[model samples]
Target: MHMMLMADEKRLCKRFFHFRIAACARAHLLRRSVCAGFLTFLIAAVFCLSLFSAAPVKADDKVLRVLAWPGYADADVVNHFEARYKARVEVTLVDSDEALWAQMHAKGTPPFDVLAANTAEIQRYTEANLLAPLDLARLPNTRKQLPRFQALASIGGLTSGGKAYAIPFTYSSMGLIYDRKQVAVAPRTMRELWNPRYRGKVLDFNSAQHNFSFTALALGYPHPFQLDPTEMRTIAHKLVDLRRNLLTYYTLPEEATAFFIQHKVALMFGNYGTQQVELLRRAGADVGYVIPDEGALAWLDCWSMTRAAADPPLALAWINYMLEPDVSALLTQRQGLANTLTAPVESSDSARIVWIGPVENIQRREDLWARIVSGDRSERF
Candidate 1:
């Protein structure tokens, strides 16, 4: 098992290297080389199909429907699966866990075989009995995953029992993206965001999750996920207090990036996905990002197989395929997030600061965030 896991890791690292190379040599690949690579991939697909054609039929065989974020599983992934298994995929895009839960309840039975949601939301779904037991025997890739990831998947720290639930997918962290030319130094702690130095020049997330977590960290809270009533009150007051100093509360990273580029803001709370910081640096804005020492919040999005999956085997197959090193690297690289199947490649400086590791602390985040948004408490931080 260890050998297999290591092999997958090496494969992931190698593929990540190729992705970096490809990114740098995109122009060269574009003119004529890309066609040859595509042809080779197609030929490989044909060979895989022939090899698997004689495999015994499984009990669960049908369209492997999935609910995921937009642009998650791309064309190559889809084609690889369809050609090999001769199966169909029906995809539905969802933006939030609340929306996903609503769909499950409204449908009575889950309409999709596989569901993608953040690590925190999976807890809610599991409690609601909306998910099925994940058979680890079927997911060899899970073993090669990082220890922190395994801890996140475990329910209260038990491996096997907890393992029977969700498969770890991708992860990212909340960080500060700033215009370096406008700021003298990067803030090492969440409290710096409130410094009068950046007052009215700070962009923030309007979403309850990021907003609340930032305050919780600034207040020296032990864990964002373990917010008590007093902690919740403190967070609410802090946000209300910061309102006057904030330039704008943004819902999307793009909006925050736009503000920074336009010189409307100097620093903003941002996640790992943006090319904004990089672009700003190149444009002479002196920009960069940081994962504050206050212990930034990290999130993992996983693939949860619904209990009512109409095609269980096919769904499992898709999950396994996604665990493939190269495939996982492609998704993580493009999406700007980390996942179970791949490790962070240091070539991208953002990868070093991007959020990784266990999500056990997230449960505290959810509750504290809820309190702040609901206006349930109003004490000063």
Candidate 2:
């Protein structure tokens, strides 16, 4: 009987290892809430065990292809997924959302089977029919996710025509990162980035979409994503002011971190927020992060399968494995990003986080932003 219990536990561990100990899953575990799935897992495990008590045979030569932002698919996470499922995992990192879109549509079959993108970007992918309808049956661990994330259809870009497309992954607010040693007081508003006191010491992300939207947010525009042409002119002038204040605009999180340390940056528009915080702290910098009174812009990134998925079941396995407590916890511990499956002790929830959405006039914003950065005066807009 003891041997049977031990064997059953091992089997159960394999089926639900990701959720058995995570904060998001622990709460549900204590409530005896996973009984239904647990039963299903037990039956499934028994069937698999009947095949072999040793490692399962690799079914095919297909590799599970993945495209994601940095820190999402750490080495250990991929290795574990590969080992458990007897499949190879290939990962590609995308720097920006625009880059991700270009890659996704770069021909017939994408180089990825699964990809991570925010709600706003996924809306574009879904609209373009570049994604495959998610088969929830294959990813039983979806039950282990946070209740808020479970309703994928409710999110703008995740579902259409009664089919789910993505699984909520990591999220973070692009808040303010101020140098505590240099600045005596923490900044309290987005408008403070324009303060002349930090001239030539402030860093902003070199992204047209972010700057235009951030400026609108700073000006108290009702919807930062949807702006009128007149609003564009007003925000353009604000960008010119911000441009004069900035030491240099950054492209990637790593670039922002390196600039912060090398240039003695006093303040930064932390596009990656805590992820950037982690990178800076690792480099031995004293920085303070905050979502100012005006609120911060946030992105809800999720995992979705591409229509060109090399192996659909294998792709779903990666998603389910990622939802595991250990994998999700690693996101907070390593990257400092919030996991959808677990709440970090550092308070992932903000009173005001303006999640990103599709913006109006993509070309116009890019054009005007270029002009502003190229020393275009306010009148140019």
Tell me the alpha-carbon RMSD of every candidate.
Answer: 16.0, 19.6
Candidate 1 local lDDT, 1-381, one digit each (tens): 999999889766644543443253334335445667889899999988987886765556457888887556787788888889888677777544545666766745547788877666676677667788777678777777777666654433112343556777776666677766777777787777777777567767655555665676767765665566677666767875564456555443444555566645777777434334544555556666777776666566787788888877778888777778887777555655666755676333443232332234444656655554333324422
lDDT of 2: 0.81
**In angstroms, how far off is 23's CA in candidate 2?**
46
Error of 2 at 255 (Å): 1.7
Worst 10 residues of 1 by lDDT: 350-359
lDDT of model 1 at position 318: 80
Winning candidate number (lDDT): 2
Residues 276-338, candidate 2: write the lDDT tens digits: 999999999999998977778999999999888877888888888888888888888888888
Question: Alpha carbon lDDT of residue 183, candidate 2?
Answer: 82
